[model samples]
Target: MIQVENLHHRFLEIEYLRIGEGHTAIIGPNGSGKTTFLKLCAGIELPERGTVTISGKEPRAVNTGWVGEVPDNNLVFRTVADEVASALRFGRVRADEIKPAACAVLSEMGISHLSSRATHTLSGGEKVLVACAAALALPPEILILDETDTHLDRKAAENLETMIQRRPAPCVLQCTQDMDTASRADRVIYFEHGHPRYIGTPEETFSHLYNTEMYPSLWRIAGCI
Candidate 1:
């Protein structure tokens, strides 16, 4: 479980919020604090006030896997294999075990063919997948995707979604504008003006957003409203 109380950082503020284990989609207009909230959860930025904890520990104490909107930002190494192994190296997973572990995750992601390639030479979609592979190689306790699908095509997005649904992490937080994608989450958080205005299951959350563009098109086709 993730807990937040009196969260205040820059433009974001939350009196209290609790997020349980599962995939949770966060949706809202631009500058609504979606990314800020994820950053806090990922321990990338400290809240100026209050506390944020995961599974009873401070977020910084937990291992976190993060894939941001820009694929290049998540990647640091010059080569594919090294990039995937970077997380393991940082986590001090034993020298001899790193290569095999990276190889295993690349195979799992079906991108082993790109193992020897230079990271800068890959296309945007490929880079995103590589970033995803690196994050999952750690198999972190918290997985945060900050508009990661923005860099992926339809098929790639579907592939990533499949990987996510397999429970790579106990709690997965994705901030996305894709209503269809958000609609599939186990829970939904709708933010507006730096506050979460709605939080519940997809059906319950969407019920509050039916009249807005945030409503999933698939739901409309199914006559859910």
Candidate 2:
């Protein structure tokens, strides 16, 4: 289990709150420190105080795979195939194994055709798929998804959900404004002013916060407003 102990992060005089994890969903209004908290968990930034542990090991010390907010930021190679292959290469897998591995990953994401295309030329949604494929190729103990659903259309989102469900990991931490995604989570953490105001099942958390039921349609309504 991923455990966060007395975690505290501060920027100048402002303090971003602390939290623990167990199949968590970090939800909050804008500027509630959700992104910052995810960044700390991904070890992209260090917290000022306290500690974050992935299965009893520090995040940096562990082989934690992170898919950042911007998919393009994660791409180092020119082609999508190269980008996905790079992950396997990092693990010292042989050349013959790379194509099959990359093919499987891309096919799972339903983007196999684009594998030969230049990563920089793909659309935002396409880039997210490439980034996700690369992340899955490495299979980390902990997977952190940062607002990946935001760029996806309905069909793409469903495909993404399917892929996420199939990939089993010890810990899955997703930060999203999509209530559809939030409702699927095992537990949800609602943030207000950079602190967890509510932590429970999605139904319980949303019921207390909105004084209404939690449903996929509710998210649609929220999106319209």
Candidate 3:
């Protein structure tokens, strides 16, 4: 379980919130605290007032993986294979197992052909996929993504979405403005000005916003009137 109480960061304030294990999509306009909320959950940013905890421990204390808007920021190694293996190596997995492990993940992500390519040479979509693969190498208990779809083409987005659905991570949190992507999640959190305006299933949340221009694109994606 993820819990936040009396959480305050920047211009946002969330008094109490609890999230159970599952895929959750966070949606909001720009600067609505969506990214900040995810970052706090990922332990990327510490809250000033309240506490953010994942499974009873601070987010930083847990085994967590995150991929943000900037894919290149997540890439630390020069090559695809090396980048994917970096996480496992840091976790102290056996050296002999690293190569096969990295290869396996890359293959699973359908990027096996790029394993030998230099990381800097990959396209925007490819870089995002590789970064995601690297995060999965850690096999984290929780995974967080911030607007990663912006970098991906349709096919690449579909591929990554499929992997996210299949991964066994107990908690998957993403911040996105894409209604199509948000609709696929088990739960949706809608934010405005750093506060959650709605929290429910995708259908329920979209239905509530159907009459407002707040989500013009979402209505079409959800087939809502």
TM-score of each: 0.96, 0.88, 0.94
The C-alpha local distance difference test score for the whole of candidate 2 amounts to 0.77
What would the per-residue lDDT of candidate 3 be over residues 1-225, giving only the tens digit for each residue? 899999878988999999899989998888899988988999989998899999999999998889999877878899988899899898899999999888888877889999999999999889999999888876889999899989988888888888876665899998876777888888999999989989988878877778665554755775665
Q: Candidate 3 deviates by what RMSD? A: 1.7
- Candidate order by lDDT, decreasing, is 1, 3, 2
Worst 10 residues of 1 by lDDT: 159-168
Record all residue pairs in model 3 with backbone atoms less than 3 Å apart, i.e. clashing. none
Per-candidate Cα lDDT values, in order, are 0.91, 0.77, 0.87
User: Which of the two, 2 or 3, has more lDDT?
Assistant: 3
Please state the error at residue 6 of candidate 2 in Å: 1.9
Residue 173 shift from truth in candidate 1, angstroms = 0.3
* Model 3 ranges off by over 4 Å: 213-225
User: Which portions of model 2 miss their true places by more than 4 Å?
Assistant: 11-23, 212-225
